[model samples]
Target: GQQVMQIPQYQHVQEGEDFTTYCNSSTTLSNIQWYKQRPGGHPVFLIQLVKSGEVKKQKRLTFQFGEAKKNSSLHITATQTTDVGTYFCAGPPDSGYSTLTFGKGTMLLVSP
Candidate 1:
């Protein structure tokens, strides 16, 4: 069995500040996926990191994969109220992506 855990279960940041959330897994992962869920909306796929030491960015957001493929992180620079949401990190327990194990999630709360 595999487990995914996220830290700083909740975060509060002022607008224009920066925010980050880290994810760790008990077992090495083949790939990791990130999802964002707004206050009233369902989870939306943010990005996926596959290769070791891989890093990707979307606007002010950056995603990183650990060299060991057992950890990941998401950072938001100049955060905004719109960025408020619960961010989840997920990894497949087996070989396929059909099933995924998700972390408890880090909930980001941004204020003006």
Candidate 2:
């Protein structure tokens, strides 16, 4: 069995500050998924990274996959109240599967 390790467990940033969260897995992955869960809301799909060194961005948020496909990261620029939530990075626990094993999410707290 493999596990995904997410760092920090929690992050607090002031408005307009930057924040980053890292994810590492015990095994290589074919793809990874990012999700954002706002307070009192369910997780919402953000994006999927598949390439060895993939990078994607949505507005002020940037996502990256390590060249080895065993790690990933999410960076948010200029945090805001709208960005307050828990961000999760997940990957398939093994090959030939679509079900994902999620990290223990990095909770983001933005103070205005």
Q: Spell out the clash pairs found in candidate 2.
A: none
**Scored by Cα lDDT, where does model 1 land?**
0.93
RMSD of each: 1.2, 1.0
Task: State the C-alpha lDDT per candidate.
Answer: 0.93, 0.93
Off by over 4 Å in 1: 94-97
Cα lDDT for residue 74, candidate 2: 99
What lDDT does candidate 1 reach at residue 16? 99
Per-residue CA lDDT of model 2 for 1-112, tens digit only, reads 8799999899888999999999999988889999999889999999999998999999999999999999999999998899999999999854778778899999999999
CA shift at 60, candidate 1, in angstroms? 0.4
Writing each residue's lDDT as its tens digit, candidate 1 over 1-112 gives 7889999899999999999999999988889999999999999999999999999999999999999899999999999999999999998853554578999999999989
